[model samples]
Target chain A: MRQANLEEETAVLGFLEAMEKGLSMKVLSGGALGVVERDGIQFAVLTSQALLSLPQDLLAGAEAAGLPLGVLEGDGFHLDLQGAALVAVHTKAQTCRVTEQAAKLFLYGRNVLGDSVVWHEPGLKRGDACIVCNGRGESLGLGVVVGPFKGMREAVKPVQDLGTYLRDQDE
Target chain B: MTEPDFPVARFAAGPKIREWSRKHGFSDWMVARILQLTDRPADVLEGLLHRPPRYLRANPLRASVEEVLSRLEAKNFSLARNELDPNILKLRQAPISPGATIEHMQGLTTPQDLASASAPLALGAQPGDIVADLAAAPGVKTLHVAGDLAGGGLRERGAIIAVEPDADRMRALRFNLERCGATSVVMRNHTAQELPGKAWADRVLLDAPCTGEGTIPKDKNRRHGKPEEVTAMAALQRELVDAADRILKPGGTLVYATCTFAPEENEAQVSRLVGKGYRVEPLGFDRVASVPLVPGVTQWPGLELDPSVARARHFLPGVHPTLGFFVAKLTKRERAI
Candidate 1:
């Protein structure tokens, strides 16, 4: 089921709050992968590897703590985020997953929070992308990165009131 | 008991298909999908269809490999040691179902998960050390460790405490212990998390509870699990970890491992432990490339994993060419208290 926009905003706020306390977070937004925060903004807006690389135990643990769960079927994956759920596909990679349609909303929310966020499409590797699927289509491995640095070591923390941080900034 | 929606029978041939893909280099993703559908990979499927079935290794703890091989040979059952577990002998030829053999029904052998045996071995165990297998029910790995302990000649000095909370499984655990002849061990039905004191043992193995996502090939019933169940299991895992931390002795080693592929459960949990102050050891995958560790979580092919988290390990089916699994070893330091 798609999450409401309010849930997306709340989740984003929660994620940022958790990152501020030294946790790292990966959020699925608008069919892209991003590290929401790492070590209290020390490494913000960083690109990350596909979510598939993380250990299953950690992901299952996090999903219990409220991170989204992505399901892989014949076509791609399905993700459950706070915002409206999204469907992502790597045409070239023959991969797809569900995501939170919060990328745009989060970008807009971050603008309201007044934090400087950058937008960049991490270049694709020659043989890394899937062939059965086109560049538009992604492999089950397609993902986005969002953090303060390139390789952050902190674990992703679940934030309790990111909405408060966003609200305070909005005011 | 009510029947499982998806049954074990559905996964009987998974091992055959997986073996074929490895020899041919079929893309792992493709192989997994096809297996889910029960479509045999064309290359090796034909051979498997014509071969007679065989199973061996009737509890290595009780009988010698040579003895078992001789017995099987006498019975005209072709037995070949599994490359993964030398104790496990695959059937090259057999006149009857191996599990029905007198050796098997008498608790001489069980169809154990081969990957499960690797976790305790990864600990670099020596004789005379105290080792604990957390969540050890039906004690497959516990027996494996017992076998290792015997092989390591730690019989006089080494001891194993097999812990499991489930009542039903504890019975099976006892049965396995007896059959495996791992007598230099303690069996406890209590939860590992509930252990009374800190820094309790020199080593601890937590085959933590997981969604069993990777077991889909062998445990077909796993595929139908709902998302909510995954979330609940995750929460339980965190609690179990918290308990594990409290009981592990300072400077002691712990193997936090699982049988799932979700990042949240594997690498993510390791990250949490590192945040709590355990030191991860360096684990290299080059030596075991065919069954390489998961990236971002393994000690080798090292990257920016939490400095403390670096001591942990993670495994996958595609990389490992085995059942998807994860293992991380952490050495507890002196507690501040």
Candidate 2:
């Protein structure tokens, strides 16, 4: 694996810390980190390569933090509640509840618009990652904040679902 | 373009290929080279005109082979296991587009060509082995290596260093790696030559860029390539192969592959590495059942290749159900210093 320089390591650590603070939940601490650029958009990718080699103490710390530690597929990490890592996050992380109609669209790989959001955890800003769920509280998938949570239908954009990769026709 | 009135049965292979190239919109030089490379020029030409079957690799990191199959089958998509690689599934029919399926969205499966998938399998990377994939952009093989490293678990200790020179391709590579849940990979937006020499790997896969003669059936634009382009590609491939050799530990495996029918880019290149002390390891075709693998040719008209080149395997599009590909497995030997 390509070793990250000290500066990169610090920047990645800072980003993770900021994400944790923003989401008010624990996030991935140690893993193989790399930068991916597309259409001028850069994403920080954390792979399980480093996680698998982590010492027992570090692994324990990640587990305690309730950070979802699954492998990143395509270009994004997927969160599955069936797995132990995501199970902790599902119970602890803030969730945005959507109606049954929106849940179907969301699961079918569509972004969740503000009009579809029935309720969301307060303090979620644009770009914050959160768990998306149905009114029944079943976890649908992970989504990133794209617009503020306001009363339904004020053109409040939508959440960028991590599963968008699946819906993309272009490979 | 006017069609040449050459009779298929009466005319020699050269005339027949020339006539076919004129009828179809292919360059005469490509047809002539293909004829020299294969006995069944007509079949090869026909194969180029037809579309190959769509293949999807079941990502073991996300779900079991059984689960992925069952999910797709339930979605009304007809599927069958690939004869060569069980992880690869051929689509017979689909109620919806393959890419738009919930299974794909969930990262349980990925669309990949059979020949492309074979490169990583040939490497035989065991769990926890350090593997390097040179020219990994649009990283399909890198993800395959990562899946093998994961050992059917959600996580594994193996690491893959993926190097891609092009920025545009690197973006796609990162997207695919992330979507496939290939978390064992570390992608570098740099050429293979930029990798540190001191940090060697247990296995290295150099799927070098070439003239892509074998992919013409899928992409017609490849037929328009000039001869000088082949020479330029061979030069780049030489540097990539040399870099792969440098980063491979002694006794480590290196699988060199290309999606082209050029002997210079395939056999001649492998032969040069063989002269540099790498031992040619014959590929085990028994695992690759039903696919007719043509043994590598050692005597291309102008090229005097080592007889050891015969150890490499060639998949002709007309013969194999997939695109044309040449795969040569070599082992970095301990120097006799």
Candidate 3:
């Protein structure tokens, strides 16, 4: 693996901290990290081991530093979740809850349609990254807000599932 | 399309084979070799001309095989489960593009060929085993090993060292591995030959690059490859096999596979390994279920392969609904004290 310089490392740490906050959970450490840019899209790849072992204090410190973090609409930060405990510690107000059927579709990389959303945070708007949970409150993945919540059938047009990070069709 | 004539007597020298090649837009040389390799030349030609059903191996790391199948079926997508490997499903119909389906994008399923899925199955790396994929770029099989080593769970305990020499390919490989949710892999941007002998693995998979003759049906350019090019691939394959041998622990299994039908690259290469004290073993396809596989050829012009080479399996496009593939399983003999 190519080594990342100090700037790249800092950028990655900041991005990860932001993701942790977005998901409302702390990431463990003990894995490795690398950053690479391809075709104008930057990707931060964290090994599954690292994700499993990330310390909460380390992320807290990074957040405290107020590192400038920005994810362009087209860029991605990928984390290996194998063996990583993704506990949804935040309250229900912070999550977008979908039906059991919708949860299956969401995990399959489908956007969570408005009709499928059982509940959601009160103030979600377009392009807000929020945690997508199932009826049982398990974290399905992260979602990008595409439309505002209106009602049972009118709120949250479609939430982009986090699985899109792995959808590289270049091969 | 009208069916081609069957049982062409003297197919090796007959005009029928050439006529069939011209009719099917294949190189005459490839058709002639197919005729010589199998008695059912017509079937092989038909299989090549026809597009095989697309297969997807459900990523067990993300979802159960049953869950994936049920979701696809609920969406009205046509699918049939492989009895031998529960993870494999043949797509009979789809409401949307199979590759673009939500299941595919979510890493719940991967578009893979039936033959390509067999290499990992043949290796059968148990949980917590250290495995090495010598040529793992665009790592479909590497992901398979990772998923299997984890026992089809999100928690990965086993490790896989994926070695790909090409920089450009490594980029795509990393993308695929991430997409598939394969967290157990350690990507190394170096050739298999560079792996130190001390970094031994419990199992090694050498899906060596080859002339790709078997994929000609899917990739027409393979039909135009020169014979010398096949010889060149054989030379490289020998180097890769040597490296695999060096890094494989004693009594460890090594599965050598290729997407080509050239004897110089397949049987002859395995013969060389046997010469070096590697024992040929059954691919154990039957242990799973009945998959279409013909025995590896032992006799080819200018090459005398060991009889044990017959234990290896050859998956011809004609005999199986898959691209042409050859797989051989071998175990390195323990050295004497």
Instruction: Work out the TM-score per prediction.
Output: 0.51, 0.77, 0.76
C-alpha RMSD between model 3 and the true structure: 8.3
Error (Å) of candidate 1 at residue A19 is 71
- Report the first chain's TM-score for all candidates: 0.17, 0.46, 0.51
Per-residue lDDT tens digits for candidate 2, residues B1-337, read: 1221121111133676677778888877767777666777667777888877878889887778898888789778898897778889988898888877656655678888887777887898888788888988777787788888877676656677778888778767766766666666666677788777543688999999999988888898887877677777778888888889888888899999999988878888898888889888877653343856777888776566889988888777766778888899998887567
DockQ of 2: 0.19
- On the 0 to 100 scale, the lDDT of residue B335 in model 2 is 53
**Could you list the chain B TM-scores for each candidate?**
0.72, 0.93, 0.92
Question: Which scores better on TM-score, 1 or 2?
Answer: 2
Ranking by DockQ: 2, 3, 1
lDDT of each: 0.47, 0.68, 0.68
lDDT of 2 at A93: 44
Tens digit of lDDT per residue, candidate 3, span B1-337? 1211121112253588677767767767667766677877778888777667778888887788888988899889888887557788888988887666656655688878888888998999887787889999788898888888877556466567778888878877766776566656666677888776543688999999988988877887776766667667877888898889988888899999999888788888899899999999998784223545878888777776899999988778866777888899999888777
Score candidate 3 by lDDT.
0.68
